[model samples]
Target: MKRSLIIANRLREVLLNGHWIANTNCKEQILSVNWMQATQKVGNLNMIAALTFHINYYLVGLLTAFETGKLEISDKFSFDLPPISSESEWNKMVTDFISNSEKFADKVEQMEDSLLDQPFIDEKYGTFLRNIEGVIEHSYYHLGQISLIKKLIMQDQS
Candidate 1:
């Protein structure tokens, strides 16, 4: 298998699979979440919607860069937040995230393995690997928040 394909597959596991939500199973996390109450300063900021958006953001960026050797979205708009109005919207965001992720993996599979280590200067991150690894690290970071937030939200409901 190509290195890009390998990386993309691992990323897929993390996103659709349980890696997004603690030890939760992939089948469970895919569309199992309810909408998070819009970011209330008094409440948790890392809602499910935000995390979903973040995952897609990185995946798209990764494919565009490492695969096509370019960026799909501008840096300014890449990190923008998702709209969280209701549970339905959150579910839709989750679906969009998953779909886009698969597309990203497909794109990555087309690239040469040599591209993975090629130096590309990012405006903010300084290195291409750093940027890619940052996405994985960021996803894990938010996954922790998602797990904690889910607990807090569910606990309060009881």
Candidate 2:
């Protein structure tokens, strides 16, 4: 398999399912969660919904760069999640994450392995390989937090 395909597959696994490193994925861990549960805080940590948005923000940015050759993410605004007033709204965001993950992976797979060595958009941001693999690493990092938060939320409900 091509290196791009390999990275894409890893990205898909982290965002969706069937990842070997973690038994549960981001979708499995949060997609079905009720709005109340998703928005609940575990002490001082970010809520599940907020974390979801944050993860998707970078994914969308990278995908944008792939499509338009411009990286348009701002860390300042990345966490600005809209009001998830109902389960439907929450589900929409979850679906957006899934959809973007698929699109991003597809785009990545289309790139040559040699492209990975080139800067994502410019030299300051690092190579495409670094950013792409960074997304996987970032998603896993948040997945761990989501799992722990879900546990905490469940324990509270019990």
Candidate 3:
């Protein structure tokens, strides 16, 4: 099988479906929480909604790079999630995340295997595969946080 296909599958495994890794995907976790629960803060940790925005922020930036050949994302702005005050607002954010996740995987799946080894946008940023894998690792890290936060929130409510 092609390397791109494998990478894309791995992406889907974390973000969309296929739960062999963490036993849960972003979509499932995000969907499990209501707007109030998603926006609730547990101590100093970020809320679920913010984490979702952070992951989707990178996904959107990478997807833009994939399409336009320019990587314009900055870490400083990655967590600048707009205030989500209502269920509709929260739902829209989740919907955008799911849509972007699908698009990101599709873009990867269509890539030529050779492109994976090439530097993404520039030589300093390393290979496309490295950045793609970073997304998966970063996502799982935050997914674990989300799960823990959800538990903490639930426990607090009880």
Candidate 4:
């Protein structure tokens, strides 16, 4: 399988099915059976819901860049990503993120393997694959953070 396509598929499985977990935390650990209460943000730093949304945002952007040949990372940081401050807003954002990501990955899966190395100039990052790799690494890194933060949030609530 192509590296880009493999990464794309792996990421989807990770995001949705708990396959590429990248961290020690399990699915049950990150999610409360009652996910609604778990969506509440307890402090200035984004809670589990906001962090989850931010993860999906980067994935969506990465896949979009790959398909369109225009790479750009968002200005927002996980700590400051638009707050999932409300349950309704958080739900929509998370749901849309997931939907966009699945669509984006489908686009990536159609590309030739050699295309991954082809250059696309981004005003911020210089090349396409460089930016794509960043997205992959960043997603896994934040998945780690999400796992850790979710644990903390659950512990406090419990």
TM-score of each: 0.71, 0.96, 0.98, 0.70
lDDT of 3: 0.95
Model 3 segments more than 4 A misplaced: none
Better of 2 and 4 by TM-score: 2
Which 10 residues in a row give candidate 4 its minimum summed lDDT?
24-33
Candidate 4 on 1-158: residue-level lDDT in tens? 68778856755655545453553322333444234544655566556665666666666666666556665665655345563445667556656756765665566667677766766564555555565566556666766766667666668878
Position 60, candidate 1: lDDT: 68
lDDT of each: 0.61, 0.89, 0.95, 0.59
CA lDDT of 87 in candidate 4? 60
lDDT accuracy of residue 34 in candidate 4: 39
lDDT of 3 by residue, 14-39 (tens): 99996898889999999999999999
Question: What stretches of model 1 exceed 4 Å from their correct place?
Answer: 18-22, 25-30, 36-44, 64-79, 121-129
In terms of lDDT, which candidate is stronger, 1 or 2?
2
Residue 135 local lDDT, model 2: 89
RMSD of each: 3.8, 1.0, 0.7, 3.8
**Clashing residue pairs found in predicted model 1:** none
In the range 88-117, model 1's lDDT, one tens digit per residue, is 776677777777766765655565777666
Number of the predicted model whose TM-score against the real structure is largest: 3
- How well is each residue in 66-133 modelled by candidate 2, as lDDT tens digits? 88998888999988999888988988888998898788888888999999999879999899999888
